[model samples]
Target: MKTVYFVVLLLVALTYFTTIEASAIPHCSPWRCQQECLFKNFMKGECIQLQCVCSQKIGGIRP
Candidate 1:
């Protein structure tokens, strides 16, 4: 009986911790992408297809 109770408690604790960790992950957005690009000194930043794309000029020309 004690073993079974311990197992259940452990499972509950594990589930709670896992959920907290999952929710702690940062969600990527267009604004986040732009801020990240600006920090990296990029010319422009845009989010495309849920991905961050940074553009930088090369030799006075845009690529």
Candidate 2:
């Protein structure tokens, strides 16, 4: 009975965490771009053709 309870509790915890929505760092770029991107709440910070690009936040798993 105790073993069964532990399994059920773990499952519930995993399900609850998985359902939570969050953002992740999909792209990592240069120092300058990264600073600006995170400061502005952008998800992606990259140097595209020698230009710094700040994209909107994308949904994923991030702490």
Candidate 3:
């Protein structure tokens, strides 16, 4: 009985810690990426693989 209780408590603690760690990770959304790119003067922006990817016209030409 004591071992079962300890196991349950350990599982709960592990779950709580994992949730905190997951929430600590940064999130990059498509809209947020676009806004960030626009702020930086980029023509296009997207979130790819949890990262913000920005692109601009080449040689001052609009595309």
Report how far residue 16 has shifted in candidate 2, in Å: 58
Per-model TM-score versus the true fold: 0.45, 0.39, 0.51
Point out the higher-scoring one by TM-score: 2 or 3.
3
Q: Which candidate has the highest TM-score of all?
A: 3
Candidate 1 has an lDDT of: 0.80
TM-score of 2: 0.39
Q: Of the candidates numbered 1 and 2, which has the greater TM-score value?
A: 1
* Full-model lDDT for every candidate: 0.80, 0.75, 0.86
Q: Give the 10-residue window scoring lowest on summed lDDT in candidate 2.
A: 20-29
Kindly list the per-residue Cα lDDT of model 3 for residues 1-63, writing each as its tens digit.
Answer: 999999999999999888998778977889989988888888899888889999984347558
How do these models rank on TM-score, best leading? 3, 1, 2
Which digits, one per residue and each the tens of the lDDT, describe model 1 over residues 1-63?
999999999999999888998678655588888888888778778977657888984345457
* lDDT tens readout by residue for model 2, 1-63: 999999999998887766653223343358889788888778778888766888877654589
How many angstroms is residue 2 displaced in model 3 relative to the true structure, after the best TM-score fit? 28
Candidate 3: clashing pairs of residues: none
Best by lDDT: 3
